[model samples]
Target: MDHTAADDISHQANAWFALFHGGAPTPEQRAAWSAWMAADVRHAQAYAELENLWAASALLLQPSPAAAPVAPARLSRRRFVGLGLAASAAAVTAGAGTLWLNGVDSPFADLRTAVGERRIAYLPDGSTVEMAGHTAMNLDFSATRRAVELLHGQAFFRVRPSAAGEFSINTQAGRLHTREGEFCVSCENDAGLVAVSQGRVQVLTAGQQTELEEGLSLSFSARATGDIQRAELAQMLAWRNGRLVFFNEPLLTVVDALQRWRKGRIFIMDKQLAARRVSLILNLDHPDQMLDVLSRALAVRTTRYTDLVTLIYPA
Candidate 1:
């Protein structure tokens, strides 16, 4: 292939790499990418080259020994552009480190779901857990205890009645213990919310213990806990039905919830806009259209820099 042709193929491969790494692509996007890959053998080659470049760039970021500082490598125009794109991808991944179990990879999770995906896990002890998108957790079961550490994101758990011991969920905010119950727990921003729908839950935080009964919910952080409120189960567990119900919630809160069900990142450029309260019901079946609907409802402007980044600002 000619120089120009090869550069064009490389650029196309970079675009595909960005889209796939940005978040979980929709079925249509995946199909289109597959078709592109199959159309020409050169396409596959270009993609492989991009992957190799990225791997090398990652190695460059590591600290070197004290022997000597190596000279920087010179770059051609095409290589420079490829490296720039790789850097942006790296930045996005780093920015989302907290969401991915505080920099821990999903491969280390015993149970996990990708962006825009939900999963139901049936445990060895007959308990079941419904995991939300981008959620990760680790399970440790023994004869003396049934323990689960929620690394991040959210989950709805149904604990099976067992004489083995109390089922416990540990999170950054606190710990919850119960023998048998149905409840939802969401961990975000170094805090957590626990809503019980059945049975009872005992929450331990900051050297204090609080018990919650059915229909009650509590929010806790590393330092303190919020007042227990009557949980609106239908609204709290709406994600289970493929829906999001926000009632007078801040725009920031709504954005955070939407981020779980979709790929890419959404930023509110204005603090005023982020603090604005809104109420709406959105269906998760069409996550791509959510930002448009939200912008239209709130009279805001939404701009898409790429398939991976979006900015929301005042109209």
Candidate 2:
């Protein structure tokens, strides 16, 4: 295809999109539009591509005040990013994902959430587990045992009574052994951040064992407790109510929280932008608005490819 001709088609596609966004057209205009779309195969393809782009930018288009927000339209496109071993090692991926197009189904996953979705699962032992977006967990039970494996992402566990004995949890990072308590664990970078909401849980990483009491949080990295801190347990688990609470955290960390509920992958290409400090409260249900606010506050802009991927770069 000629480069100039392809550009012309794209330009025409954008024009048609503007007309559609402007509102319903007259009969004559609709007929002309139909004729233009049917004029050539390339014309239809070009229009479809532009429609996908518009879908990806759904946040930018707001309807009347009383109308509900529009959902993102799914469309396929060519994958752009190619990360080799070296690049993958250097690029630290960050971002929240949500609004699952397709929920997960696995024999091992007794409880799971699709991308951009969160769910609560009630275990047989009267315990409850709240799963974050893109999270999966498997429950293990026996005459003398109860355990849960955090296969991926994060979850908040409310264990059965201590009279029933200890409940063990396994993640990519380490094991959290607890009883009669509520707590949350998040896995990232081959590590786990355990925040205790009530009662104490013994954390066993490698050969070390320590008790994590209420109001205390610890980060275990690569089978070891590296950094520990105290926090407001209630604030940490605010996502149960569909909100993200952050305080003096790096922009990269914020991105991780946002990825929990937003659909598609969001890439932050600038290291400096990722490292900047941030403090804010974000509503998980309105992820598009969240991204718009972040981009403006961080002096950045997003380049989206349909609804498949979103890339963030300095403006």
TM-score against native, each model: 0.68, 0.69
| Candidate 2 lDDT tens digits, 1-315 | 998797567656655655575447789988888999999999999777656543533443343377674454443432344422222455655563332334353436777787667888888778898888778888887667888888777888898784557899888788889878988998754778898878888888887887888867998866568655664553477678676656457888887777667766666777987788875556677776777656644578876655646667778
Question: Please, what is the whole-model Cα lDDT of each candidate in the order they appear?
Answer: 0.77, 0.70
lDDT of 2 at 188: 51
Off by over 4 Å in 1: 1-105
In the predicted model 1, the residue pairs found to clash are none
Q: Which candidate is the best by TM-score?
A: 2
Candidate 2, 88: how far from true, in Å? 5.2
lDDT tens readout by residue for model 1, 1-315: 797787567557756765674457899999999999999999998777656644543343343465463333455667655744654554222223343322224678899888778889998789999998888899999777799999888999999988778999999899999999999999975699999989999999997899999978999988999999877665678788776766568887888888788776666777777788986666677776677667656789876654555667789
